[model samples]
Target: MSKVVLVTGASSGIGKAIATFLSEKGYKVYGTSRNPKNIEDFNFKLIALDVLNIETITTAIASIIKLEGKIDILVNNAGIGVTGPIEETPTDEMRNAFNTNFFGAIDVIKTVLPHMRKQKSGLIINTTSIAGYMGLPFRGIYSSSKGALELVTEAIRMEVKRYGIDLVNVAPGDFATDIISRRYHTPLFDDSVYKENYKANLDLMDAHVDTGKNPIEMAEKVYKIIHTKNPKIHYKVGGFLEKFSIVLKRILPDTWFEKLLMNHYKL
Candidate 1:
């Protein structure tokens, strides 16, 4: 029997790429979107899901398990981004970001753990980003939420090791995806000090993503991860500068690294 895989936020972008790749490769794959009707053009099975909705998650997982009898892979790829000055960013937007990016992943994991533990074999891939590595100038909330997710993935790895479950955080650097259009910016006030700077910074950020690696690159990485017997705890995907930035963070002095980022964004 083929391995059964479930990926969240599969309606478009990276999630869709992964689901399509895996399905074509013969794995039984299910892709998720809040509106199932929207995924009809996709190759894999479509499952309606709103990660923020516990009931939706519960029903989606149950429906998958009922058909496949097991979930060998769970990809937490559903997330939303909020951009702008952290201080001016509304509390609700920040909460929505965390709710969708962090807690949604947590909820899905909680729901799937029991089944995976019973089977005693599974892979859980959490799609994070380069932003998680450092706080950006205008995209503080989105970066911070992914940073929280990074920590959550780390802590859960140790807890799930004995259960034969492999958890990895895939931090892709600015992949081209629908997330660009879907991104939510904190309300920008014209009279605010951050208005002009935030506009420029947000545009630069979008340009980076618009020109970044394609989703297929990350999808290919996920395929390799699935085939490997022992995958790394973290997989960084993207071009030289983006992936290398993580290396620099590790070896460079804190002040130097901080200044580099600040200067890059003209903060």
Candidate 2:
């Protein structure tokens, strides 16, 4: 029997690529989005799901359980990026980022745990980012949310080990996703105060994202992790810069790393 997999945020980018790749691998796949209408691929079943909506999440998972009978893998990939200085960012905007990136993922895991626990077998993959490991300028909110997700995945992995379920975190350094184009910049702050600072950093981020790895590359890494007999707690995917960033984070002094980032982006 083919393994059953459910992926959220499947409308485009890495989520879409992962859904397509998994389906092609013969897994019984269900891809979800905020609206079923946004789903263009007819290859996999489209389910309406907004991670912030608990009712919608519950309903979607219930329906999937009813139809598929079991879920072999759950990919928590639904998230939004918010860019702004921490002090300039509104509290509400930070809450919204957490709601989608952290709480929303927890909601899905809570809903699916019972099924996976009963089956005593399943894999949960959380789509985190390199930002989770190290904070970046103008990405405080996004980084905080992903950092929270990283911790949640770690805790869940250890807790669910006895239940025969696995939790894995996939932290892509900088993928060529529409996340940058679709990013929400909170304007609640005094733009005039940090306009130049914000613009400089945001521009650099946009440029880096444009030249990042293809979403298909990330999807392939995800596919491999899912099929591994014993996947690691965390997997990093990206270019040489990504690996270097991780190494720098480990070996460099805090002030030095900060200087490096500021100097590199001319921020």
Candidate 3:
């Protein structure tokens, strides 16, 4: 039987690409959106699931399990983008980001684990971001939320290994997606000290996404990982410089790396 797959946040963007690609590849793919009805002509099944809502997460997972009898793979792609200066960004917004991007992913994993453990086989691929590897200007909250999830994946993978389940993080660089419009921007305040610089960086951020790689690249990577018998804890999919930036951070000294980023973002 073809593997049963669940991909959250599949209403559009990378999540949609991944879901559609896998369905084309013959997997029993089920995608999620906060409002499924709004999405029409989707190639695969779309379920209503708001990652921040535990009840919805549980319901979605249970419905999949009821139909498929087992969920062979889970793509934790449900998340929102949050951009702002840490100091000026409201505490509530930061909390909201963590709640959805971090805790929300965990909740889905928690809900699905029992079924996977019983089957003694499962693969979970998390859609993290290249930004998660470091702190970037104006995108700090977005970076932190994804970064936290990356760390949690590192820890949880080991804990779940004995149960014959695998967890992997797929961090992609900016992709041409609707995320730019959907992302929350902590307003450009008229009197804020960092207003000018923040606006510049925000435009830079938008440009990156506009010129980003196709979401299909990420979908292909996920497909490859699912087929691998032994996949690594982390896989990054993006252009050369974006992937190399992670390497630069590793080899360069902290201050030097920070300076490099400052120059790149023109801060």
Candidates' lDDT values, in order?
Answer: 0.90, 0.88, 0.94
How many clashes does each candidate structure show, in the order listed?
A: 0, 0, 0
lDDT of 3 by residue, 117-201 (tens): 9999999999999999999988888899999999999999999999999999999998999898889999999999999999998
Arranged by lDDT with the best first, the candidates are: 3, 1, 2
TM-score of each: 0.97, 0.95, 0.98
Give per-residue CA lDDT, model 1, range 1-267, as digits (tens): 999999999988999999999999999999999988855598898988899999999999999999989999999999998897878888898899999999999999999999999999899999998889887788888889999999999899999989999999999888887776798977779888988888888889889888878899989999999989999888889889888888899999999999998788877
- Which scores greater on TM-score, model 1 or model 2? 1
> Which candidate order results from sorting by TM-score in descending order?
3, 1, 2
Q: Model 1: number of clashes?
A: 0
For model 1, the superposed segments whose C-alpha errors exceed 4 Å read: none
Best by TM-score: 3
Runs in model 2 lying further than 4 Å from the true structure: 38-40, 188-191
Clashing pairs in 3: none
